[model samples]
Target: MAERYAISSGSAYEEKYGYARAVVDGDRVHVSGTTGFDYATMTISDDVAEQAEQCLRTIDAALTEAGGSIADVVRVRYLLPDGADFEACAPVLSRWFGAVRPAATMMVVGLLDPRMKIEIEAEARLTR
Candidate 1:
């Protein structure tokens, strides 16, 4: 079996820690938890909706690089700093997942970064 690892742009996986953004094995790609931080500015949006959008954008980029697309996603996990933000960000999430309705879970938790109110993680399979 061949194994491969990847680190997406704007990610500090190797520098901050020592992990790849995604690891590929066989037909599966396990993407790491992705946050909505603008790589260009190294800043995170204060709004939950914008943050969610940014998180999905980052996840999409990782999926694309891993020989997968949003359609190939099997599951998604969302972490929100406040439970109240769920409704505020749900519409954005629905729009992003309108076509690909993968299994999903959203929860409220204290995040590693205080300014970050949302983080998203996903798993996808390589198709063809």
Candidate 2:
């Protein structure tokens, strides 16, 4: 069996919700739906664009710990309560994903917190 490892962002929700921020199985890394909340400060920005940037930052850290980077991302999912906010985040998304060109999906859905404007999840396969 392949080794399974879990990574934490030190978000209280990870402990309260009983889910890891990311999990690595073999060479694959699965990142959870990450919000804008900075784990270190436990603070979030009201602007959707700022939130989107923060989400990617968190995901990148998790991927790096799993021996990978954003370029290794093969799949990505974007969730937001307001579809309109998606446009504001497009540039931030493109900055991180443009060259990598991962399979992607976007959905408008309610989040656990009303303050959360967006959530992102990603899957990556280690190439090195």
User: For this target, which candidate reaches the highest TM-score against the unseen true structure?
Assistant: 2
The digit string of per-residue lDDT tens for model 2 on 18-123 reads 9999999999999999999998999999999999999999999999988899999999999999999999999999999999999999999999999999999999
TM-score, every prediction: 0.91, 0.98
Candidate 2 regions off by >4 Å?
Answer: none
- Model 1 earns a TM-score of 0.91
lDDT of 1 by residue, 24-127 (tens): 77678787777778765788888989998988888788788877888888899998888898898889989988889999998888888888888888888888
How big is the positional error of residue 57 in model 2, measured in Å on the Cα after superposition? 0.4
Model 2, C-alpha of 106: deviation from truth (Å): 0.4
Best by lDDT: 2
Against the true structure, candidate 2 has what lDDT? Answer: 0.97
Q: Candidate 1: minimum summed lDDT over ten consecutive residues — where?
A: 6-15
Worst 10 residues of 2 by lDDT: 62-71
